[model samples]
Target chain A: MTPVPDPSEEWRRLDRRTVLVTAAVLTGVAGGAGLPTVLGLAGAMPLWRAVTWVLAGAALLVGGGAAADYVRWRRTRYRVGAERAELRTGLLLVKRRSLARERIRSVDLTAHPLLRVLGLVKVRIGTGENAGGESTLELDPVTKAEGERLRRELLDRVRPDAPDSPHDGALAVLDPGWIRYAPASFVAPLLGGAAAGAVMQVSEWFGAQGEVIEWIGDRFQDTSVLGMIVVLVLLALLAGTVGALGLWVEMWWNYRLEREPGGTLRVRRGLFTARSISIEERRLRGVELVEPLGVRMCRAARVDAVATGLVKDDEDKHADHKTLLPPAPRDLADRVAAQVLRESEAPTGAPLTAHPRAARTRRLRWALGSALAPVAVLAVLGAALTPVLLYAAAGCALVLVPLAVLLALDAYRNLGHGITGDYLVTRSGTVRRTTVALQRGGVIGWTVKQSSFQRRAGVLTLTATTAAGEGAYDIHDAGEGEGLAFAAEAVPDLLAPFLKPTGVRDAGVETRKTRG
Target chain B: MTGENAIRDEVRLRPPRNAVDERAVTWWRTQLLLTTTVPVVVLGVLGALLQPARFWLLLTAGAVAVAGLAATAFFPAWWFRVHRWEVTEDAVYVRTGAFWQEWRIAPMSRIQTVDTVRGPLEQFFRLSTVTVTTASSKGAIRIEGLDHQLAADLAERLTRITQDTPGDAT
Candidate 1:
């Protein structure tokens, strides 16, 4: 079905609801600005006068903003033509932007809580150029239905002769059971810490700091310090769990991944602030299965699309909009990845070849060294300061040593690399394990690095440099001979011309001997 | 013997020779001297005015300035000798660095943009710097100290090559 609107139609303005949103926003700003004055005048001035002043301030701000917004809404106009999508905006400067239909890569729609209530959404049409904001055209407060129609019309450029078309069906949808994994994420502890800090900060602000501390101390009066500490930790954890669950629900309440008509993979999600992201099938390279330490322990993983032109707009948001599936069962993540790639088998699930033993040794030494540095510093400080510091140093070492060893072992276990069919899979890390299944053809070059230590150990780091995804996938500490051979085999003739006949030594004995 | 050993042996040998402009040494020395002189002069004047007792500091500063100027005059010539770039049909090779040498090879097809930049100092010297930007996160590779005409010609040639080759879907 043709999704294009009538070409004869004139440039249309945004939804009328934007005026109300602007008024509401201005009222909020006025209230925030006048709060201090209201509180200061609470005692000296008459109550009605104070109220009148606040009301007048709010009314004036809202009236001015609403009038300006009305003018802006009147001036701003957008037209979706057969060849280009044009947006003419700016009150005085008269900035006009038009993106060619063929160059449009993605059409993303976002609706905040207010916009959602008003049935309006902001649409950002991108050309996938890395030229910052210049490559995108924003249409704020468009009707939800109009936004959807625009998305479909702009992205309906599927190849006619394609053998296997994109499956026009829901690939993945949110499962309520996945919410259990939400609190299990790293964000839980962070939220817990933030909650603890907020409590202290708020108490201090209200001049009730002593009362709160005294109450806390009284509750733990009969208990030992250790017991009280444990209780506080548990309380923080509980608070964190609730915050994480609430955040998860807000972000992924009705998350749905669907293959829309015309080879577009669209994700519609969020509860209060709904988001619709469309990724063209042709730009997709592969999928990444990320399993953080906590998530991996729970056998849950998140899936991200490794596609070109999916540049992250915000550094603060984890996973950004590239997340295909929230933290779920590893098997489910793999299945969703397979669906995204339109392949029978998920490339990430395959057993990858392990790196040499020397690599593990190197990791262990580094981890141990890192863990010991702090301990050594504490010991030195203890020696210089007091005997009490020695106890703290001992306590630190007692906790850190084992944890460091475990992480080192985990990192070693996670290190592996393999090539399966048209994809090369590389897995690494301990705290945040990532298994990337990258397209072999996407790789532009191979970088081989051998530090003085690595060279002595007869190992090198081989990086498959690509423009898409994380820019580069590295197979760390592969035996020198094996890495070169792998590089040569992966790209055939690319590395062969540089390699000498003497370089192709067997991987096992030399790496082992060098470590000894 | 393994193939990797042969490759490593070849890499150890000097790469292809395509030296930068000879005047680059004088240009670099002048730039270095100019940068160093201001800071040295400022420190010396501040010391002389603010703390007359620390006049020994001024002597030390003068000595450092002399040493810096001497190094600046000598180091650029060595740097100029080391800096080299070669553009082949398939790839562009650039070798640079003073203490820790770096050799970068970017495939011709990976190049997205080629630009020629000339600063006021470079304009005075009739020299230009050519930058080849690839899609790689490693950032652009710059080949400085080329004759103005040569830089423009190289930029044009690289642009033409990039256009002719189909860009990788990145």
Candidate 2:
């Protein structure tokens, strides 16, 4: 902002509207929870008395939350100094934390509906170091413009000498057509199952569990049991599809991926609760192409940044903070991934070297072993108990065996590893296939694992350990020679000291050729 | 068997240059003994006091004791033979594990921190464990059962070496 002279040593308090935001959030929480409390209490006391108690509790909850946040607002003070960004807070046990200004990698702005209404956003300044809370300063609620200004100032950097600007600026904006992929994700069935569970849970809370069950039973009374089950599953699926569509809209309505002037890739999205996430280009190690089973069948994939210090907090572990694009067409995902990494073509889309036959055999064995375990147990119980149980076990085998085999084959087909330019790529998994293109320079270490069975199978797992993304990406069940050669090729001399030369290839010859 | 032999011949990870201190075997034995004895002894005493008439309880305790004794007799030496560590001018190489082997290599430039840990049993045997941590979460190389003085010197040397060559250790 205001590029006024000197006077940068000033401290600033959080926006006073933080208290109001807290109060509103608490009211919503109390309202949702209080209705159930009143219903439960009504059974033990007069309805009017229960209502009065609930109202009193809600008032107390809101008042207490607002008062605590007010104290917090009073205690917190932050300053963006020339060399360091420091924060001082805590009422009883005072704590002061600071990050060297140059080390601050990201300045994110998030505003839920309440904060949006109040024109305030929560600002999180991070060093992109995974040292927990010590490396981050969170301002609960600051003016929206102040948040934006802080983000710009903190992330502003001197442009690199040779700016690669071809793929810069508004890399990909939201395509409303992408919404079709929402129902194809695994989230749909999960949401459907969750919806069914919630219905039962809510009805139970209202002490209408029996009535709800009776009502369902009465509706299906004329239908056969199999027909009823099919109809109910269909209804749950319908509910799930609608829920998934709504969730997709809420999360990705205004999705935009932009590359700013200073090499920062920004993802701005969300409808009611807007989030602006920034990832410094220098911190990015690579990109991952994620294809959940259903999405892959639809020829769609999601792109996630493989970068240092993009870890999600424990509370939001399920949130994909690194996602640059929602599920889109495969080629679009690849293009966005390529642009994200500033490469002409995506490394993840490179032709990968398939793993040896042993890897397929391994997957087949595992799939069959897992699928047969339950069948064996059922068969044993059936043999010991009843003929009816035996028939059920047979039916189970008939359904599970082919499905498991298909998945095993699919997983086998997905196994691949390759190198494209500066990135080393690996792909695996059946249900949730992921192709990770990791910058070879970012690989810090290598771990070679050989279980007794794996050794017997003539395969081993090679893990490229890096500080980015998942910390380690595995090339599973690779041929021993192929894996070692790939490792040596990927990082030159990192794995050289530990590898022994084969008889036919002299170590010196190998070195001379490889170095050349 | 011929195919297995051919696969084994394809690529091999040379064992690291140095073996851990000889006392590591005894230290590991003492540690494993303590872990196994405590539970077995507790079970035996509780069973004798509360269910003395239940002969099966005593038999079960006896069986556990035999198994523990056999493991204490052999496992430590087996593990010691497989556990090795070597630090070169470029990187740190380590080979660990007994049944399932792991070979790790982390370049000197990637090391973030160097630490020395001494457990009570390790201290009793005058041994220390030197841990070299890299930015990667999975890249912590542990060189266990070194002479206490040697471990300290190693950690100090690593710290000095990595301090001069680094790009934020990432």
Candidate 3:
């Protein structure tokens, strides 16, 4: 065992290069602010005078920011002792924070292009407590080497006997070919819609909506109405594809998932702003394979770590850092999941027991009801108002009914739960199908919910509540008996002792009747 | 199958009935009436004073407040009858909710912390509420209307059980 280092020790300051980075950011901001003023003064004022004014403003801002940053850097000190990692900063107020070493669950590193150029990275050491800013200690602008060392030393929990293991290797690396799935994501169409909305908003803001609409109309004047609509849609799709590709590149460029000498799993990704998220293996509860509709159709899925102490905060910059694997071939995703769990086979790929047809009926009814609401509203409007409204009603019915039915059927098909060795797998959803292979041991409690409607349908929602991941994995619309039985079997005595005898027997009979 | 049936029968055996102190009903009734009536009375006065033309509104509000006060006074006795909790060697069973009855079972091993809280009203009534926090995201399970001494005892017992049970890393 390593000796516990002294806590009451001298605090070390961050690298001086932080001042340069701070000054550069302030200069950029000043330039952006001064641009409009300079442009407005182009003809009104003397060119040299205007230019000098802008230059002076930029210099003053940068100079003041750099001086402040220098003082901040000087005052900001961090120390990683055996028991705790402490950070103290602020020139006037003097704020101090210390995270117990045992409670330290994650040490994430981030470096933007500017910081990267200067070989500096920002390190955030978190205790994994869900309590806002109080749980994290940030050390901004540390040297690259120092960052790497801190990551290793802070996360070093390897067994002394085994200095290196075969598992200590790059589990997954960025595949350029995976970029094709970027445009295939559902985000593409969403981005396209957002772009169109943005165009309208900007034009409205500038009072150029009429001019923009006229320009579009003139461009498509020669085409037939149908052809014009098709062309517009295709153009929107093209723009969407480009936007999705750029977003994908920015978020996932150079993505690498690797296992260190210790039991830490590190995910390094991003292009302009690189991020390194470290998760201890012991804290990892499981992995979730996410297949959004578009990506699923493309035979691709994303992987996420379902680990304890990886609390998502509103202010957390690396909110999406939970993504362990980028959208890739489902086969590759499965393999990476298995590798992360240190298992020979991925639990997600295991065959799951399908839910009863009653579940399907429920989903179908819900889908039809939801889809018909708009149609019903439109039909009422059409009857009361113009015939043009009737056409819209017809259009809505024609598009929504079939789509809703398909989604409902797909959701029914996806509803399944199974246990494979140490993990219990539960699959659900239509738009964003998720198969979570949660560790059975991780589940601390069970909640069985049966509403009056559910009781009439002889179905119940059983949730395995754990401390990690989403905190609960639910098996929705399962036959009450089957769900109870499964829950009892999954965790053994936990749920068994709570169920009434007659209730269990009746549920068993019901289960048999439904299955038969 | 027979062993399973036996276990089921054992499960069906009603959990130990530990009802809250009898004074809790009086406390709850008083608190409920005070909370509901004070707000309504103020609103009624404000309505009559601010808008004399809507004096009928003030009468209507008073009537509704009376009805609400009556319901609040009566509901506490009914709630006191239904709201019960039992702490077994291995689990804590709390049965709550009025119209939609909910029975929550939290395993002793999963318990992270057990706390006894006394609000101003509860303190005045010499009562405390026990909160058993588990690792589950559904949040803590609270058992209100307990004698202060009983609440302390329960909290201590739960804490001791949790400490004794291994594999409670959470």
Candidate 4:
């Protein structure tokens, strides 16, 4: 593939991080170097006396600068040459090393407010170990579009262009709700910060009111702890409301993801130093289609993919960001689910993998959740000893009522895993009911587990592994041979067009099924 | 289909360990107790010999020695016995829980790296270990008691898979 320079390159220089950091350094130097002459002309304090503080401050600034420049020089530049990506760095003791690009695994990018202001971001490329694993390179202050551009360059040098890019119209258009990941991210953090602030304010306010109470004590008793608690609770409700509203306002910024013409997802966000990341459909490892308990009842779900690389555009700030499918209308979960799971290719072929709602797994989650009942019962029993214990037991029961119901319901909803063509997908979650997907070729391995009783029931839970950890993409329950069947039946022999740099396997699936 | 077959093919670890060095430091309590108590036992033994007026001093050293020895011997044994792994064709399986019983596996395709390690104890026992790391979480799966050649071969095989796996997004 003859390399095509990125169409987005012009926008790269538009970042402010490069400008700000450079400007800040220049400004500090100008002020420090120019100060002596300026003070000398004014003849302030004895020139000798003035020279001491001015010289001292100047030395501190420039001396401090030598270290700063070295650190910046170290983390700032990374060049991926023809065969290798060499990362050279260090402020004092400079170092340089290059990993074969073919050995490169995943590249991560994160952009924060400061980086956004500077119009720059950070990018990290992880090549598993030594010359291969965990060889990391960070590029700071790259333009907003540069990360994707670098990824594109790396992709071109490594493989042919991705086959199923969004331009092919193979992927369904998704509507991203800032509410999905953002609510928990933005709202929870906001409320938590506000709550701490509120506590401090309440204490100060009450302390100030104490003087008034001292005079009014003859007419009315001092506000009791109960009264103070009640007031604090009311304040908490007020704070939560205000915090939520503020977060909603912050949510209005550009947090959109466009499905590019090349069957790839391009997600861009951040109000100032806008960050954009590209996720190829082929790199979809596993989907964490979360239907959080609250969202489940509301019939909504947030589908997040266990994508291969981090968005390099934002890493100057958010160094570790997962490029994902934004939340869409719940009804659309099924619509776009197949493409996200690698089941839909315009070319003719059976979808290789499976979905969670497969036959045997329908009851798998229920069995596992019900198994927790004994432990919960034991704890409940252990709490019922004295009068205070009885009240505590009652309180715990109230909490368990919702916990058990939610778990059981969520389990029942999540119960299913079966082939969805060459793409293996599992759909589960209470709030954001999800449909997770992964290409057979994208599968790293398979896991089978059976509890003692499950062994008795003749059932084993199977999870299809992908590069994405914790969120194994698919879990199925089937007859013993079903595991091997998944590997033999689905895993792709040919790599998908634009397979993830390090995620796709060139070998047969390994079925690691067993009872623990 | 039988439990015996499952035992032989026990899916001991989850596919692709999320972290490198994924094993929990379960022996930390035992290690902590032994390191702290052993020196105290030595001090007590010396003190008892120097000042024999307190006959019970010898009993104190015996008690510490008993706890330290029990922890040291049983701890490493339990750690090794409970932690087991099997890299089947599809996934690297691990079964690591001592009591509650949890099984995990990482796919060969998902494995980021496979490492072979021969710890001081394993070398003495003529055994080797294979450590598997994945792109997922920081957790890793280490399978001990394999022959040295087998461990090296498995690591080579795993690295090959990781290298060839083709998610183009990297």
Q: What share of the true interface contacts does each candidate keep?
A: 0.12, 0.63, 0.27, 0.16
In the predicted model 3, the residue pairs found to clash are none
Q: Candidate 4, residues A1-516: lDDT per residue as tens digits?
A: 123484422212223344456546656785756564545533657767676666676667665665565456535445666677776666566777677877555554556666655546666665533232336666765765677667666544323565555434434433334354344433444575678675655544445445544544543356786776666566665676567545544432465544544445555554444445555544555555555544545555455656654332331433124534344455555444544554444111122223223333444455445655654665666676445645555676666656766565555555444455455555544434455555555665444556655555444566665554343554544433444344444554311111112222222223432211
Over A254-325, each residue of candidate 3 has an lDDT whose tens digit, in order, gives 888999878889999989988899998878999999999889999999999998777464654434857899
Q: Is candidate 1 or candidate 4 better by TM-score?
A: 1
Model 1 chain A lDDT-worst window of ten: A507-516
DockQ: the better of candidates 1 and 3? 3
What value does DockQ give for candidate 2?
0.51
TM-score of each: 0.86, 0.95, 0.85, 0.60
Ranking by DockQ: 2, 3, 1, 4
Candidate 4 lDDT over B1-170, as tens digits, reads 33323322222223323221223233334444758586766768676677764456666666777777677656555545556655556566666543334455455555666778886655654557788876544335766557676677778887776778775311
> Where does model 3 exceed 4 Å of error?
A1-10, A36-60, A160-166, A197-210, A222-233, A311-319, A385-391, A503-516, B1-82, B98-101, B120-127, B163-168
Clashes of 1: 12
Q: Show the lowest summed lDDT stretch of 10 residues, model 3 chain B.
A: B2-11
Q: Is candidate 1 or candidate 2 better by DockQ?
A: 2
Mind giving the per-residue lDDT tens digits that candidate 3 earns over B1-170?
42223222222323336887887898888788887777787777778687765677687778878887888867887778767888888888776655444556678889988889999989999999999887766646789889999899889989998989887445
Candidate 2, A379-497: lDDT as tens digits = 99999998788888899899999999999999999999988999999999999999999999999999999998987887899999999888999999988876787788899998876
